[model samples]
Target: MPLTPIDPRLDPGVSAALAAVAEREVDQVFFVACGGSLSIMHPAKFMLDQHSAALPSDVLNAAEFVARAPKRLTKQSLVVLCSMTGTTKETVAATKFAQSAGALTLVLTTDPASPLAEAGDHAIGFEAPYTTGVPIDAKNSNYARIYQLVLGLAKIFDGSDKLGALMDSLEALQPAIDRAHTHFAPLFADYAPRLAKKDVIYTMASGADYGAAYSFAICVLMEMQWINSHAIHANEFFHGPFEVLDENASFVLFKGLDSTRPLTERAETFLHRFGATENILVLDAAELDLSGIDAGLAGNLVPLIFFDTLWRFAYKIADLRDQEMLEARRYMKKLHDY
Candidate 1:
């Protein structure tokens, strides 16, 4: 069944908030968050990097941003922070720090009343399946909201006319995700036992999709399933990591239609010829039916769609290994001190 189509319009409050930021002198944009939240910021920064001609952007880990404060982060900067629960201590602290620096802070979280939200100058709440434990309208997800924010900034600062196209693309994201689930179901089932047996798994991607690889490796495999995993950029794979290639090595490679597709494709060709690893799994964005999305915007949206698809694979591996994917964390929030 097709998912309900999302309204191809920005939320009124989100639009108003961006308008308020446009009134300010924002010379730079910083996206600050922790863990999965941080991962989501990467594609936004990448999008802005590709489109915005004037405004510089950076994605920073929340704790690192607070510790190593950038000199450019001043009153003329806009800082965006995101957290699913809004209580992530590092992100909340970063938001307060940005506010103290007199930077305009925009916060995105599922919880409107979260400390991170309150710390920011402007807050936009979004619905997430992780928070709600049910499928949500794609337009209300963090990916969509953050992409909207980036597109809004581009439209205002770079004089871009891609927002309407972006809206159309976002509307198609959920159905793409749904199709991915159905398409990958049998493959994930077949791959689960092999993945579960692996002591370490390496994820690889380049360009805009790298964040999805990183989040799946760290957040899903390492944190949730307690597996050893690392995300290696395809652009860097040939330089050093490729030496580890052998029949025993396990990898999940993400391929997207972005400009850096060749980087991953090069690595993919090498992996097949030299790695000799039957455990290699490639999740290509091209495999999904994206006919509803704009051609120019579909590549950028790959991370969001890939994240959703990879999430199901994580669950499959977890079930195969008899590991509790979510509640079995040993040292995360349960620890009093890291």
Candidate 2:
């Protein structure tokens, strides 16, 4: 079935937030969040790194951002933070810390009434499956909002013209994701039994797609399913991690169309040659139908597309192991004191 098309328009709040940032002499960008929120910021930082020559950016964990207290974080800095519930203690503290430094802060969350939203200089609300059980199209996701904000900043600071093409791609993202889900469904089911037997699953990827692999390993596999997992950078896989790759080991490699794709392809080549063929599952973005997106920009959006598809695979493995994805948490939110 064809998924519902997303509206191509940016949220009005995004425009206003960009306008506010444009008024400042912003010198640097810091993406601050925790867990999956931090993962989504990786591609935004990568986008700015590729397109903006003068603006420097970094993705920082919320608690670390507050603790490290970089000297560069000042009135001239733009701090962007995301928390799905807008109530993450570390994130809220980071938002207040950024504001205390007189930095321009933009917070993305699902509610206007959230404490994180109330604390930021600007806030943009997004629809997400985490907050609402109903699945929203990718266009309205926190990743889309962050990407749009980064594209806007790139345009304002570096005079880049990629936002229009990106908006167009966002409109087509849902159908592409639908097609990918359809294609990967049976493959995931077939792989689930073998995957369930593994004690630890390693996820590998490079460039912008690395964040997706990281999130799947930590958030989905470890947090949700209570599986032992680690995410490895494909570029660094050759350094020392390859020694651990035997036929009994399992891995999920993500290959995207970005400049760092060759790095992952090298890892894939070695994985096959080492006789780990049956235990390795490769998810290549090149296999997805991205005709709706501009060729130059499609690679930049691959992480968003991969997230939608890999989420289904998470459920498949969880089902095979009789684990409850949502209700199985032991210490995530149950503890009062850390």
Best by lDDT: 2
1-338 in candidate 2: lDDT tens per residue? 11111223667768778878877899989999999889988888887888899799889999999999999999999999999999898999999999999999999999999999999999998988877999899889887888889888887888786878888988888888889898888778778889887889999998888888899999999999988998999978899998998988899999998888999999999999884677898888888888688787777788888888888888888888888888779998877788
| Candidate 1 structure quality by residue, lDDT tens digits, 1-338 | 11221223887547766877878888989999988999889888888888889899889999999999999999999999999999999999998899899999999988888897788888898998888899897778888888888888877777776888988887788888888889888878878889888899999998899888999999999999888998999989989999998888889999998889999999899889876456888888888898789988888888888888888888888888888888879998788876
Q: What is the C-alpha lDDT of each candidate?
A: 0.86, 0.87
Q: Model 2, residue 225: what's the lDDT?
A: 90
TM-score of each: 0.95, 0.96
Q: Give the Cα error of residue 202 in candidate 2, in Å.
A: 0.9
Off by over 4 Å in 2: 1-8
**Model 1: residues >4 Å from true position, as ranges?**
1-8
The per-prediction tally of clashing pairs is 0, 0
Q: Model 2 Cα RMSD, Å?
A: 4.6
